[model samples]
Target: MTRTLVVIGHGMTGHRLVDTVRDLDPAGHWRVVVLAEERDPAYDRVRLSAYLEGHSRTELSLVEPDFLTDPRVDLYTARPAVHVDRKTRTVRTADGDEIGYDALVLATGSRPFVPPVPGRELRNCFVQRTLDDVDALRAAVRGGQPAVVIGGGLLGIEAAHGLRLLGMQPHIVEFAPHLMPTQLDADAARVLQRGATALGLRLHCGTAVTSVDAGPDDAVRSVTLANGTVLDTDLVVFAAGIRPRDDLAVTPDLERGERGGFLVDAYCRTADEHIWAVGECAAVLGRCHGLIAPGYRMAESVARQLTDHPAEPFDGTDTSTTLKLLGVHVATFGTMPVRDSQAVEVTFAEGTTRYAKVFLQTSTGTLLGGILAGKTGSRTELTPHVGRRPPADLEQLLLPD
Candidate 1:
């Protein structure tokens, strides 16, 4: 008899697990059932902001047209798995249906965190996550008034640029001292700030929003800052961050991380041997990985183990990131801050056109990590050399060719 595998949450990592499993297990050892809360199938949530640039829904979808037609795999959209009963090895759906499973995988992903502020629920206040959220924001943007984005991280900058493209004056309000604070150092962030400003975005760094005030129509009229400054706005977009979805953690025997994700072993196995967790929902080694690359790696690892193939325990993922935001190139790899005592650093800036920094082991000259802002031409090649020594001299490596 074939085993039943129930997978919850049809996000990118979830879909990747299913695809990987199907490709490896062509013998049909396990039948798969996927439960997704969203009506649409898995799509590229990383490129979600591209929707504002005229990318269609189908273009962003990660689902293949013939994926659901496989007899071994069954996908249920808009049907969320509400309860997990380890006693019977079954999962209860929101529609009052319970499906028995031999193995369970939770890939519930994460939800946008809206800060606790007054009038946040008022009209025109939105969080950019799913296609539905972006579509609603697209329709609501009339493009004359100024829009305030509550975060200055990657998503916040993307939201600001999207709104700017819609003809609204975009203002980025960041609680941190600089933009992309987690990814780039102070000097690199400064370069990114100039690029953002040149792209027509207004920056408000080291500021916190005290409260959101609404008008008589229950729509956002203005936002007040902690420093006693008020700014008028048309809409408020909250891109603060995300919280892992661990709703099923209430079930007995299910372990959860302190920071709100399912606690799993290096093998991606939960407390119960029959259950496993992967992607943003899974916390490995006490921390949850929020990047897509790490999530993909986790999915592949779990798929290999389930298919009875040789697999290595997931140690940790490289937090290196490279992306273009608002027509500005930004890349950071290895460690963001050189915290070691014996660390050597090099910096070079070509007027207003570029700024680059590289960290090396002081004694051995091994490349540890670095940041490149403004005209990151060799980011692709340099990223792979993150933990290794550069091929050439440090001076030649930092030069903009």
Candidate 2:
């Protein structure tokens, strides 16, 4: 009898797993079923900003039909796994079909977290998550009106840039003292925020939105701030954060994180050895790996271990990230939250508002983490800086001094 490998999410991780399984077992020894909750097939969600900025669905798809041609791969879209039975190793769908599986993988992924502010039921207030979200946002702001984006991290800033690309006045409201509080240091955050403001993105840091006000029926009219200031805008989209899909975890008696994510071991195995987990929905070593690269690493590890390849263990790294904002370059990586023993250094730009700063461990002179702006010519060299300990002056290595 052929073993059934059921993957519960058709995001990037599930797509990667299917491809990996095919390469491992080309023959018809295992059946693959992907339970995708969203419509429009599997897409690259990391590029959703690009999609919102005018890129079509075809440009944002990572797995085209050619990749899904394997007869073994079965796709079920818009169908959620309603229940799971670890004792009998089966997952029941919304339609009451209990799909039996030998090895189960829940990659149910995450959902956008929306706060309980007033007027949340307004038609123009949205949480950016699915292609449906981008579509709704585009239609809402079709008049090229002013837009307000809540939050200031990666998603918030990127969405702000996307709005500016769509020819709307982008306004960012952040509760934190600095933009990208998780990614950039205080000084770096100010620099990037300045870059954003120069691009006509009004910044409202160090403040929280008290409530959203809707006019007439259920349409967003203006946003009220904690400071009692009301900013008039037709649209309000929340890029706040992500919440993992853990409704089915209870069905299998699986352990979950405090913030609600499936718990998994290094091999991506859950409490039940036969069932596994990966991606942002699964917490490994207490971390919800949000970046696509780490998710791929987890998927590759599980695939190799299952095929008897016996690959070495995966060491989780500080997921550093860089991105372009309305043509401005911004990035941050490792040891960003400075400690007492870390050495902080900086370099300003020659004529433009570009600069680079690095933080290092005082004792070992090892890179702790840092950020770069204006010029990203040294971005690719970060892999070598973090991957291995190269014996050289860090500044010289970063810019040839």
Candidate 3:
């Protein structure tokens, strides 16, 4: 008897699960169906900003033809899955196709959060979340137009950089006081801001767009800020924040977080034992890990258990991350954000705007977390220390007094 497996949401995490399952059981005893809401089979959402910045889609493919002439896997693109009835163990699609499954994986992923500001519905106002969203933003900025991006996170910075490449003046409006606030400490954030500015991106820190104004009836004229300053723009791109897609979590017997993410066990099992979910949609250890590595681990474990294979429960991971924006490199790892009250601490911060900061625990040498401002070159190598806090020599190492 062939075991059946159905994966909803063919984002990177979903497709990766399909491939991993096939590898774990090469005998072809598992039926894999991947339903993607996007029109094209999954490429890579992590590099979507790169595509928006002018890179070709072929550069970001995990698998060229999706299956490359293999028919064992069935992929449905632009098709949204509507209902999952655990009673019958079936998933119905928006396209009127019902798929019965022995087991299910939900990788519904996350969506860009657009705040309810006035005039957001105006033409040329866009949200950059998917390839479709990127394409629309590109189309909105035709003929060397200027664009204002809302949010200063990784996606927003990437979108702004990409927009600049297309000859669109890219400007960022951030509610936070600095760039990449969540990823980098205050000093590091300022350093990153300077790097972007050197690249010709306008940074509006501690500022937010209150309303969008349509020039005529067809395009955005400008964005009105809380400071009453209007920056003229031909297009508006919202890379604001991400919210887990949990439209299906409202049903009975399902556990969900206050912020709209599904609650899952260490094995990635939902409240319903027969069903499992991973990726951004599932919150693990009281945190929704938005990185790719964690989501992939979740998927691998869920599939293994269902097939009667050895499965490792997610013992929890030390969340550490490092990434490059335009040309600036920045990193954050492990327990860097812990309140100083719990751990011995050492710090060094300096910049004209006071850019870089590195936090370390005093007594027990742990990487804890680091913040980089002007030059984040050390972050790439030092980030791994975040998971396992290294020596307190971090202060003397990064900066010699």
Question: What ranking of all candidate models by TM-score puts the best one first?
Answer: 1, 2, 3
Model 1 collision count = 0
Shift of residue 83 alpha carbon in model 3, Å: 0.6
Total clashes in model 2, counting residue pairs 3 or more apart in sequence or in different chains = 0
**Which 10 consecutive positions of candidate 2 have the poorest summed lDDT?**
344-353
Off by over 4 Å in 2: 333-352, 387-393, 396-401
Question: In what order do the candidates fall by lDDT, top score first?
Answer: 1, 2, 3
Q: Highest lDDT, which number?
A: 1
Off by over 4 Å in 3: 65-68, 249-253, 307-309, 315-317, 348-363, 372-401
Residue 384 shift from truth in candidate 3, angstroms: 5.8
Q: For model 3, how does the per-residue alpha-carbon lDDT over 1-401 read when each residue is reduced to its tens digit? A: 78678888988888778888877777778878888888877788888877876777677677656474556688888988988888888889998888998878889999888989988888888887777788887776665666899999988898888888888888899999998776766656766777788888988889889999877565688999998989998788888989888786323446776666778889888777767788898877556777787888888887687666899987554555667776766665555555644555454655533334555556665556655544433655566566466655665545445
The digit string of per-residue lDDT tens for model 1 on 1-401 reads: 79999999999999999999999999999999999999999999988788976699899999886787888899999999989989888899999999999999999999999999988999999999999999989988977789999999989999999888888998899999999887877888888888899978988899899998998898999999988889898699999988899876336657789897989989889888999899998988678988887888889999998999998888564677788876667887766543666878888878756778888887787777778888755666777776687777555555557
Model 2 TM-score on a 0 to 1 scale: 0.92
Q: TM-score of every model?
A: 0.95, 0.92, 0.90
List the candidate 1 regions with Cα displacement exceeding 4 Å: 337-342
lDDT of 2 by residue, 1-401 (tens): 67898988888888887778878977768898878778777788888888988899888887867666878788888887878888888888888888999888888888887878888778888777889989988887754688889999888988888888888987899988988877666766766877887888998988998888888877888999888778999889898878787777445478987667887877777778888888888888666876787788888888777666776555565567777765667876664634655564555443445666776666666666667766544656764675335346655544443
Q: What is the lDDT of every predicted structure here? A: 0.86, 0.78, 0.76
Residue 142 in candidate 3, Cα distance off native in Å: 4.0
- Superposed by TM-score, candidate 2 places the C-alpha of residue 349 at a distance from the truth, in angstroms, of 6.4
